[model samples]
Target: MPIGRADVSPPHWRKSSYSNGSGGACIEVADNLPHTIPVRDSKNPTRTPLLFTPDAWASFVTAVAIGRLAD
Candidate 1:
Protein backbone atom coordinates (compact mmCIF):
# COMPACT_ATOMS: atom_id res chain seq x y z
CA MET A 1 0.00 0.00 0.00
CA PRO A 2 2.90 2.37 -0.55
CA ILE A 3 1.81 5.54 -2.33
CA GLY A 4 4.89 7.17 -3.80
CA ARG A 5 6.68 5.97 -6.91
CA ALA A 6 9.35 3.51 -5.81
CA ASP A 7 12.78 4.33 -7.13
CA VAL A 8 13.67 1.51 -9.51
CA SER A 9 17.40 2.02 -9.91
CA PRO A 10 19.41 -1.17 -9.71
CA PRO A 11 20.15 -2.02 -6.11
CA HIS A 12 23.54 -3.05 -4.78
CA TRP A 13 22.64 -5.81 -2.38
CA ARG A 14 24.67 -6.56 0.72
CA LYS A 15 24.43 -9.55 3.01
CA SER A 16 23.23 -9.01 6.54
CA SER A 17 25.97 -8.67 9.12
CA TYR A 18 24.30 -11.41 11.09
CA SER A 19 24.24 -13.81 8.16
CA ASN A 20 25.84 -17.23 8.50
CA GLY A 21 29.50 -17.23 7.53
CA SER A 22 29.06 -20.11 5.13
CA GLY A 23 26.36 -18.30 3.07
CA GLY A 24 23.60 -20.56 4.30
CA ALA A 25 20.01 -19.40 4.82
CA CYS A 26 20.17 -15.62 4.96
CA ILE A 27 18.77 -12.35 3.64
CA GLU A 28 20.39 -9.61 1.55
CA VAL A 29 19.43 -5.98 1.73
CA ALA A 30 19.99 -3.21 -0.79
CA ASP A 31 20.19 0.28 0.67
CA ASN A 32 21.31 2.11 -2.40
CA LEU A 33 18.03 3.48 -3.70
CA PRO A 34 15.93 6.18 -2.12
CA HIS A 35 12.86 5.46 -0.05
CA THR A 36 13.18 1.72 -0.36
CA ILE A 37 14.98 -1.20 1.18
CA PRO A 38 15.11 -4.23 -1.06
CA VAL A 39 15.36 -7.60 0.63
CA ARG A 40 15.94 -10.95 -1.02
CA ASP A 41 16.86 -14.44 0.03
CA SER A 42 20.46 -15.45 -0.49
CA LYS A 43 19.34 -18.87 -1.69
CA ASN A 44 17.41 -17.34 -4.60
CA PRO A 45 19.08 -14.18 -5.81
CA THR A 46 17.18 -14.13 -9.08
CA ARG A 47 13.81 -13.90 -7.40
CA THR A 48 12.00 -10.64 -6.84
CA PRO A 49 12.86 -8.92 -3.60
CA LEU A 50 10.46 -7.74 -0.94
CA LEU A 51 10.51 -3.94 -0.79
CA PHE A 52 10.11 -2.06 2.45
CA THR A 53 9.97 1.63 3.19
CA PRO A 54 12.79 3.02 5.29
CA ASP A 55 10.62 3.45 8.38
CA ALA A 56 9.14 0.00 8.12
CA TRP A 57 12.53 -1.60 7.63
CA ALA A 58 13.91 0.16 10.69
CA SER A 59 10.98 -0.95 12.79
CA PHE A 60 11.38 -4.53 11.69
CA VAL A 61 15.08 -4.46 12.53
CA THR A 62 14.41 -3.07 15.98
CA ALA A 63 11.83 -5.74 16.65
CA VAL A 64 14.18 -8.47 15.58
CA ALA A 65 17.00 -7.11 17.71
CA ILE A 66 14.77 -7.07 20.78
CA GLY A 67 13.65 -10.71 20.36
CA ARG A 68 10.08 -9.64 19.67
CA LEU A 69 9.88 -12.08 16.79
CA ALA A 70 11.26 -15.14 18.53
CA ASP A 71 9.16 -18.29 18.62
Candidate 2:
Protein backbone atom coordinates (compact mmCIF):
# COMPACT_ATOMS: atom_id res chain seq x y z
CA MET A 1 0.00 0.00 0.00
CA PRO A 2 1.18 3.49 -0.79
CA ILE A 3 1.55 6.01 2.04
CA GLY A 4 -0.54 9.12 1.76
CA ARG A 5 0.06 12.59 3.17
CA ALA A 6 -2.49 12.10 5.92
CA ASP A 7 -0.87 8.94 7.26
CA VAL A 8 1.62 10.67 9.53
CA SER A 9 1.21 13.15 12.33
CA PRO A 10 3.03 16.40 12.79
CA PRO A 11 6.00 15.66 14.99
CA HIS A 12 8.88 16.77 17.06
CA TRP A 13 12.06 15.43 15.46
CA ARG A 14 15.71 14.73 16.03
CA LYS A 15 18.72 14.34 13.77
CA SER A 16 20.32 10.98 13.09
CA SER A 17 23.56 10.13 14.89
CA TYR A 18 25.18 9.43 11.55
CA SER A 19 24.65 13.01 10.44
CA ASN A 20 27.67 15.22 10.32
CA GLY A 21 28.07 17.53 13.31
CA SER A 22 28.10 20.52 10.97
CA GLY A 23 24.63 19.52 9.73
CA GLY A 24 25.67 18.33 6.31
CA ALA A 25 23.85 15.08 5.47
CA CYS A 26 21.45 15.83 8.26
CA ILE A 27 18.58 13.35 8.59
CA GLU A 28 15.66 13.97 10.91
CA VAL A 29 13.45 11.30 12.45
CA ALA A 30 10.23 11.67 14.38
CA ASP A 31 9.57 9.91 17.66
CA ASN A 32 6.50 8.56 19.54
CA LEU A 33 4.69 7.48 16.37
CA PRO A 34 3.50 3.93 15.95
CA HIS A 35 3.85 1.64 12.89
CA THR A 36 5.68 4.15 10.72
CA ILE A 37 8.97 5.96 10.48
CA PRO A 38 8.87 9.63 9.41
CA VAL A 39 12.09 11.14 8.21
CA ARG A 40 12.83 14.62 6.92
CA ASP A 41 15.57 17.07 6.25
CA SER A 42 17.04 18.54 9.38
CA LYS A 43 17.77 21.68 7.41
CA ASN A 44 14.18 21.96 6.34
CA PRO A 45 11.97 20.55 9.05
CA THR A 46 8.86 22.11 7.57
CA ARG A 47 9.11 20.11 4.36
CA THR A 48 7.11 16.96 3.71
CA PRO A 49 8.69 13.90 5.30
CA LEU A 50 9.47 10.58 3.72
CA LEU A 51 7.72 7.69 5.43
CA PHE A 52 9.13 4.24 5.90
CA THR A 53 7.57 1.04 7.16
CA PRO A 54 9.07 0.07 10.50
CA ASP A 55 10.47 -3.12 8.97
CA ALA A 56 12.14 -1.18 6.17
CA TRP A 57 13.70 1.17 8.67
CA ALA A 58 14.96 -1.79 10.68
CA SER A 59 16.52 -3.37 7.65
CA PHE A 60 18.21 -0.11 6.69
CA VAL A 61 19.58 0.27 10.18
CA THR A 62 20.82 -3.29 10.19
CA ALA A 63 22.58 -2.70 6.89
CA VAL A 64 24.27 0.39 8.24
CA ALA A 65 25.24 -1.43 11.41
CA ILE A 66 26.92 -4.18 9.40
CA GLY A 67 28.85 -1.68 7.25
CA ARG A 68 26.81 -2.32 4.16
CA LEU A 69 26.04 1.37 3.61
CA ALA A 70 29.44 2.80 4.38
CA ASP A 71 31.73 4.41 1.83
lDDT of 1 by residue, 1-57 (tens): 367776879899899987898878699999998888999999899999998988999
Top of the candidates by lDDT = 1
Reference-based TM-score, model 1: 0.81
How well does candidate 2 score on lDDT at residue 46? 80
Q: How many steric clashes does model 2 contain?
A: 0
Q: After superposition, how far is residue 27 of candidate 1 from its true place, in Å?
A: 0.8
Best by TM-score: 1
What are the RMSD figures for all models against the true structure? 2.4, 3.3
lDDT of 2 by residue, 1-71 (tens): 45554446666688899999986899999765777788999899888899897889889999999999999
